[model samples]
Target: MDTALIVTVVVALTAWVFLLRSSMISMIWGPVVRSAGGDAVWAAVTSVVLYIAGLAAFALVVLAVHWALGGLPARALVLVLSALYAPVAFMPAPDRGARPYEDVRRALVRAGATEEQARACAWATGPLAFAGLAVVGGAVISVFAG
Candidate 1:
């Protein structure tokens, strides 16, 4: 199996999970944090841009490491990080955003926002669930590829 593929798969998946978590946080509290004049649309656009930038940075560093040292060490770092991430990725996503805000969101739920709407109110969004499958699929592909 090619190490580029392994690195690419793992790095991108890690990046995406991080992006999803950030996006969820934004959706959950973009309004409160920037209440006076926050644009959700713009906030989302910014998050995607940041994710792309970070992913590019990660790819460059990992690929450079692969070229300078060797593939095994580069892949090993990602593999270990993913192992540490397994508990978070495997566990159920928390019902609301991260804490402090979770309390506010809970209050919103009590104040009459619908279950789905209170937590996930947004103008536009990405398909995070299907996107998660891409990560899973990448892992499955890597397995079969070897």
Candidate 2:
């Protein structure tokens, strides 16, 4: 219903998907490929379904923010949304590994994650790192916001 909310949601969602693309695409693609014995059609269907689900969740987050905050002015709403997502969109260290931290990665390898599975878990770092940063950022903002 609100234009700014709409824009912010669309942009933030786009950024999230872009940020998640490489690894997650691999993740979704892997299963269907295996289960259907490398069926391109099944892989495509699975990918589409998963993507739509992710987008829906992003929409829900925006709606929740709107309802919880009562109605931020468009500018302010956009600012808050940016604050929430920017850290995720632009990670501080591009070269740094995304997840399973160094120790975790080693442990995963030791535990028998198959090279591919271990790599996938390592990619989990991308989302995990961003989610961690977002939570911390939100906490900092909350302290200042109040």
Candidate 3:
């Protein structure tokens, strides 16, 4: 297999793992955190749901772009889309009374996590969700480079 293809596959796998982790955290832990009276478990759950939904959306977009472009161009299109979607992983929780990340943080703190620990946890999980796109982008570039 081409190195580019390998890179692409790796990235996609990474992204999938991140998405799965996020979903699992929300589904399994969301309720526990909420029951504990953490800030806004619902909001955090909503964000996780949204994040998963966004990944689905990106997948559809990739399929559509592939269909439209065909072959190499499809890869290019995927790269562009991935690049565009990458930043969303880092989005802060909703403010204006919307508390998703904050809710999670509150729960973590209640669970004896320090502020730094909670933030670090958020940073770790949040970015993993975007790893797939990053892989796609890397794969596209690698393929095109050859």
Candidate 4:
């Protein structure tokens, strides 16, 4: 509600959106686009628009959580969410044959990365990276928010 908190939320959400978009493009869509001989510019533009929309929706959720929790510090909320996500995010993919996993791996491989590299990239750019960002960002925000 205060100026400091508003500032913090804006900065945090912006960073989150940036990281998400970058990972999505580089590790996911970029490969697909390249393999399909699509226009990178158009893909980038569409991705940015979609990501910004997602950012707006996520911002509303963050605000709603802040209010619903009776002014719980956003930093604390972030930390809690990150903690909850860690197990699920870090867990090995249950099935390599799953559509999403196979598609991502295939894309990366088609983009000229080796099988091992594709696997690593898929894991890195997926939930693991986002959850890690949340944890680290939350910790840093806590230090300053406190």
Best by lDDT: 3
Point out the higher-scoring one by TM-score: 3 or 4: 3
Against the unseen true structure, what C-alpha lDDT does each candidate score?
0.43, 0.44, 0.52, 0.47
Evaluate candidate 3 by giving its C-alpha RMSD to the native, one decimal. Answer: 11.1
Instruction: Give the alpha carbon lDDT tens digit for every residue of 1-146 in model 2.
Output: 55676566556654764565344324443443345333445533543454345444544565565456643453356456644544433221124445434433343345433445434444443344454345434432432342
Kindly report which residue stretches of model 2 are placed more than 4 angstroms away from their true locations once superposed. Answer: 1-20, 27-35, 70-146
All candidates: TM-score? 0.39, 0.34, 0.43, 0.35
Per-residue accuracy of model 1 over 1-146 as CA lDDT, tens digit each: 77788688667765765555544444433443243233444444543444344434544554454466554565565455444333223221333545523533453344344434433432112233333344444433434343
lDDT of 4 at 19: 42
Q: Name the lDDT of candidate 2.
A: 0.44
Ranking by TM-score: 3, 1, 4, 2
lDDT of 3 by residue, 1-146 (tens): 47777677557744654455344444443443445343454434544566666666776777677677778788766766655555454342222335446644654555544555455445444554455445445544543554
Which window of ten consecutive residues has the lowest lDDT sum in model 1?
Answer: 121-130
What are the RMSD figures for all models against the true structure?
9.3, 11.6, 11.1, 11.9
lDDT per residue (tens digit) for residues 3-119 in model 4: 787577556654554445434435544444444344444433443344344434544555565566633466567555533333323222223475545655565556555565555
Comparing 2 and 4 on lDDT, the stronger one: 4
Ranking by lDDT: 3, 4, 2, 1
